[model samples]
Target: MSPPHAVIAGAGIGGLCSALCLARAGWRVSLYEKAKILEESGAGLQLSPNACAVLRKLGVLERLTPFALAPQAIRIRRARDGATLALMPLNDAEARWGAPYLVVHRADLQRALLDAVAHEGRISLQTDAAVTGFAYGSDGVAVAISRGASRLEATGDCLIGADGLRSFVRQKLSPDDLNFSGRTAWRAVVEADRVPAAMRSEETTLWLGRKAHLVHYPLRQGTIINVVAIVDEDFQPDTDNFWSSHGASKFLEARFSRWDKSARDLLSAAPEWRKWPLADRAPAARLVSGRVALLGDAAHPMLPFLAQGAAQAIEDAGVLAEVLARGQDVEASFRAYQEIRLPRVTRVQKESRRQAVIYHLGGPAAFLRDAAMRALGGETMLARYDWLYRVRESPGQK
Candidate 1:
């Protein structure tokens, strides 16, 4: 008998990782993307041990290590005064979580997943093939792909929407829309040499300020530093695109005007910057419908405060493959997938938003946040996330 087939939309980390896991599980897979060509762009992302375990299981960790950096610690500070609030030791995070926490360039992770997918005989990947919709029946699913003016379709046992925040598959599954959060972020990467000595440490640092926060970490083997500065503000898009490069340097400079000099220097060093208005949806009561299911940003988009956006998606991929490889009824497998994922991602989503509020606290609240951090201690703060990092398995997974 032939192996079951799985069709996946979106070639981002979530989609690619899911494709790799499923192909390894003896499923014939087809991966689709809307981009014309895969390029090394976008800011860095942190891979806590939870996601690292999945990558190691998928056998891509070795390939990724060359392009990734393992931070020694996570440092939290007051952005205005530059005073230390807490210092969380991460060197021992591996021993605790069973895998090391890694910070990697988004492009590097994508490249690693793409390379692994290429070697797998069970997976076929296509570029510029946008997933328009899918129709499911008793036997399987027929997924529609729009390539330029041509429309093509492929059949599979089930469809997985690893597509991002604006998922076409998600719209078909539910009539919900992603609501924009009243905040904007500036993401940029600069060479290590261009950054100040204080900012070049191999530790991820979070600088908390009034109504804003700054996060920076070493990437690409410490040759580059990824900086993300977010502030509470309103954005009115004149165009349909939620992301655009039309930000003024002066505006960014003014927003962080009261931050520490080191951070401001780093911001000035970034020759170019792009602005993204954060958007998320309230956790859906259902993430699966019959033979279809949503994964990653499509299922639960959250603020970047917790840095588990990609990690949760990678986790989804692993659990999805483990459940479906059982060869149970396809619809039941999808339902099982959602049942295991919804609660976990929902908690992360809520925590991420809560952290955003804490990070952007003002005046007396900001002072209290710092005092509380100092009292809680960095180790304790780090330990608090044990639920997120120390994960061996989810429901229905061995």
Candidate 2:
């Protein structure tokens, strides 16, 4: 009997990782990317040990190491005075989680995934092919794709939408329920050499202030530093129209000007900046519909406070591949995928929302929050995150 064929939409991290996993599991996988050319254009991303372990299992970790930085700690501070509130040690991350935490340029990670997908002979990646629509039935799932004036259709035993938050496949599945999270995020990368020597450190630093917070970490072996500033605001300009959009540095500086000198210096050095209006959907009543299923941001889009957006998506790929490769019934495998992923992703989503509030507290509330952090101590704060960093795919499952 022939291995089942899988069709994947959107060739971002999730989609490409899905293709890598499925193809390695002996399934014939085809990935469609709407962009004319494959280019990794994001600022940077942090991959906790949990994410690293999954990628290691998929044989892409070693190739990505050159582009990654393994920070020794994560420090949260008061934005007004740069006083440390909580410091979580990450030096022993690999020993605890079975893989090292990684900070890499977003483009570098994408390149690694794309490279692995290309090397997997069972995977067919079609760039410039945009998935226009999909139809599912008991027999199978069929997808319509377009590239300029030409259009094509393909059929597979199952379909996975890893198309991200604005997924067309998701629109087909649940059109009316998408909800915005009432937040906006600004991101930029500054060369580490440009930052003052005293400010350059091998640690992830976070500054929590009223109505906004900033996170910074070294990527590319300290050659560059990635900064993400998130603010809770009344109005967020719609950035959903374009996948990559540039934002004004002056605007970002004005918003964060009152922050500590270190943060202001870092922001001032940023050469490019982009804005993303954060949004999400409630956990779907069901992530699977007939032969069609959703994965990654399409299935769950969460706030980045927890930094689990990509990690959860990577986890979804690993679990889904294992279930399908075991030769289980297709419907059962789809059901298992949803069952295993929904609860965890939902919890992460809610926790991320909660963190947003804690990070943006003001005056008396902010003092209380910091006092609690000090009382808990850095070790305790690190302990609180064990549940997040320790999750891994069951070894005996496959």
Regions of candidate 1 where Cα sits further than 4 Å from its true position:
394-398
What TM-score, over all chains together, does every model reach? 0.97, 0.96
In the range 28-132, model 2's lDDT, one tens digit per residue, is: 998999998877656778898878888998889988998888888999899998999988899999887678988888888988897888789999999999999
Query: Best candidate per TM-score, number?
Result: 1
lDDT of 1 by residue, 1-398 (tens): 98888999998888999999999889999999999997644679899999999999888998999989999999998888788999999998778988999999988888899889989999999999999978998888999999999999999989999888888899888878677788888888898999878889999999999888889999987888998888898777533676655567899899989888888899999878877888878887888988998999888888888998889999999989988988799888888888888888999999999998889999898888889999999889988989889958554543
lDDT of each: 0.88, 0.85
Candidate 1 residue pairs in backbone clash = none
List runs of model 2 lying over 4 Å from the truth. 239-244, 393-398
